[model samples]
Target: MITTIISQTANVRDVQVETIGDRTTIFRSRTWDRLKFEIEYAQQKGTTANSYLIQSDKVALIDPPGESFTKIFLEKLQQHFNLASLDYVIVGHINANRMATLSKILEIAPHIQVIASKPAIKSLKEVFGQYTSQFHTPNHDLDLGQGHRLQFISIPTPRWPDGLATYDNATSILYTDKFFGTHVCSDTLWDEDWKKLDHDRRYYFNCLHSNQTKQVETILEKFSTFKSKYYAPNHGPVIRYSLSRLIYDYRQWCQAQQTKTFSVALFYASAYGSTTILTNAIAQGLEAQGVHPLLINCELATPEEITQVMENVDGFLIGSPTLAGHAPVQIQTALGIILNTATKNKLAGVFGSYGWSGEALDLIEGKLRDANYRFGCNTFRVCFSPKEEDLVKAQQLGSDFAQNLQKSKKNRPLTLPTNNINNLSSDRTEKALNHIIGSLCVVSFKQGEMDKAILTKNISQASFIPPGIMIALTQEQKTELLPEIGTSFVVNILKEGRNLRRYFSPSSINTINSFNELETKRATNDCLIFDQALAYLECTVEQITELGNKWLIYAMVNHGELLANTGITAII
Candidate 1:
């Protein structure tokens, strides 16, 4: 993957160009030195804003990188071809952040047509204001000459309503903007080091797609008509070799998120992206407890959508940012919807950020309290933007709220299906399955400052080449560390220790940190390796699939050592 440098300056941007296909070149405006404001951008993985240039009898540039790369991106573009040669400047989505870059493009290529989805066109008009007439909304496929016909698909998600994807019929390449994208930057043109990229890709998926699974699934189905050889996404490595595998992975991941039993409707209105950061942290906390979080940016979410989510969820969380000492109009509208549609028995939570007075937080807190809603935790409020400590606190509060909800439902009757079927065969199958036992193990993991462990009897080898193993456990409130794909953990194979299982079993009080009482050593992955265990395998979660109330986590073994060679493996 040799990069052809077109232009570079000391303090300015460095534009690297790589030709991926016959007539397609990727102009990647990489911001390796500076970090963006978004939560995903701060990941420190080195981000790239990929812009593709297609040359045929006509020319088109798809998706100019955001405002940060405005000057240098245009400078690099000037080095290769005349601005007049660029026929179309196609945008996958529209937002205020990219206005500067788009404005620069319009200035340089005044005669060039701008192509986008109908919804995106509206945003373009709003952003461009007086220059709205320069835009062209696409209702049908456009031919760019030399047998290169372009097709646009309007695949909108709640967070990004103006979302669109482009396909080049000539090269059979799908330019999936934001779909199947990670924030990591590298010189590798394809996903050849997929094993190393698993963590970053899964993290990106969880941040964006966890709440948008339904829309993502629909888009996947809609894209099935196209025979795409490569998925040239907006960021990360282009999918040249692992296209089919990535698509299947996305489907499985989204299905698992959507199929969770307990769900939370998280409504928030972010000002300057602060509230969104807090929202993501809290969502991560809920997901760690096996509670599916339905994130809704109130600014984009409709009243009907809010009502539907509140009705289906077991609990709800509301967060907002204060502007002019009041909650945003969108937050107010969401509050009204919640008051009307939500029941008194459902658990509720409130959190927000404010620059000056926290009147908005008090307003939301009072409204929920007056409506006889039970508070899952204390109302959390932070000043201005949340710091690292604040985000961590928010996450911990969310985790505590989820655990409280589960505790309240401890003695509640299991809601079984009403459809009458073969009861005898089901009972026989259950008994037969339980009779087959395996080695009892304690799975422990550490992410950031938090450490957690779980007791499990279901463990088996999933692969031999990678030396992998699969561990399956039921979703529980006390379980703070759900084995998400890309996380690292250690499997401590117990040595005929029945008491160890009891210690790790579910209790009224969470004792996940009970390992402090035992002799443990930290593995290279930073997971607590039990000293008394028969053996331990340091592994990274490779994939996660859901089965009923349990999550089947598959991990690739990275390191292992035998602690007690003569000890027999503990059986369930």
Candidate 2:
């Protein structure tokens, strides 16, 4: 009976090539299981590889799914129109995986012209033998015949340097390949349930866009010039109702990263995609420490841009995959730029993967050493393939790098004031760990229409992209302020003081006056927040795990604002 139900749900007909608007059809490939292409999709739930067909007088297909769906995709595509009639295939980007499907498409439709950005065209010619004849790099408006006029825009990011999008004049639908997309599969074709997808959408941005905020801000600016009523992304749903909200949110997320007090720039290039994986783990580590690392793809970044980033960041890390006993040309160029551009006082770290000789890693380490730059950690290296443990270590390296950068900024050292000697020794470990676990903040919530707050130094940041934190709550705290998944709350970081801490002590929590007694204001999420705090993060609970004696809660941060620009986080 279970098998029968599963089979019924996996019906191919559930999501087929269907008309969504005038002259536009969506060839959505739905998967109930994981899409194992990239790290973002690999660990998460299922996703859709959305392909679109525009049936203008000159027919064009936009952003086909990867080779995984080649046979079935070809089969269904032939049912509607003749393969020979498909004139142009507008490819948003080129990857080895997607090239396989493009190969199959060429095998069936030999004369189909491929349209892409200049970078993508170069890749297409290099990958596909026959692509030289029909490849086109559109630098201006592209007429698809009749009313379906189109324009191509290049919005290159670190992860996808060849990213491109198309805008249809008649329908006002922007065919976005990677922009404004989420990694989730659905039977529906439209983004009608935009609220539930908020978390996933934010998570997707964190994974892909957070590090490339500079490029993303440029993309958003490009988007504003377009008169698009909806966005047809290559994953999840067609963004209609949520288009405006998402655009604004993307800007806000980018602004948050841009305005950070201490920033680290992470530069990387992966030969076989191994170093890329390590780079992501390291980025997660930085995020866990509440620092947003600026990611730069050496392959895509110009020398001037690289130099500018190195000059602005407080610290920077460089990672490169070895090729023929040396670093890739891009990395070598970046190394030269780094040596010339960055001051020796900044923190430096190097990491990468290699087949045999790791001279590339050695060269970077040696160069920085000669410059007298301080090393946060040893050079991280992975040979042939990286295991689970390597990723964990890479993440630790990132976390350590962030911690070191933060420590370097502090003018004063942390010294404990004299307390009861017996009590200090009893809980020294937990107390010491608490200081560095997360920010020292008072978490506030509303229970039964009354505002409540708790002094928590254990709210550890868990995910950076989706903006989330993990918190362990005592039984008393749990009962005082209920925390179920999806509930909204605010975590307010405190300024350096002793008065607020005394008010939220275990003995004083029960006897405190009304929340109104404190100088507070309402958050954007409608939760109470202390006006004098360093900053506040608006969060919605995502998961709950029960430990032996404590309840662990993971919540996604929706929005955050710095209340006092000069106020530092309280380290009580």
Q: Give the per-residue lDDT of model 1 (tens digit) for 1-572.
A: 34554222343346778788878888888755444644466577667788999988889999899877788788887887787678888999876657778887777777778898787787678777767776887888889887789999988876676789999998998999989888876556688877777788888888777877888999999788899998988888888877887888899999899899788878998776677778888887888798888888787776678877876788898998888877876786677557655666579999988898888888788767755689888999888878888888888887888898787666756543322222322222121111112457787877467777777767765654545777776665214565367788787877664356666753222244665778778888887887887677878878878888878877887776656423345665
Against the true structure, what is each candidate's TM-score? 0.66, 0.68
- Model 2 lowest lDDT segment of ten: 428-437
How far residue 161's Cα lies from its native spot in candidate 1, in Å, is 2.1
Residue by residue across 58-94, what tens digits does model 2's lDDT show? 8999988887777777777777778778898998988
For candidate 2, the per-residue lDDT at 181 reads: 85
Q: Which portions of model 1 miss their true places by more than 4 Å?
A: 5-13, 31-34, 41-43, 270-273, 299-302, 322-330, 353-358, 381-397, 413-572
RMSD of each: 24.7, 24.4
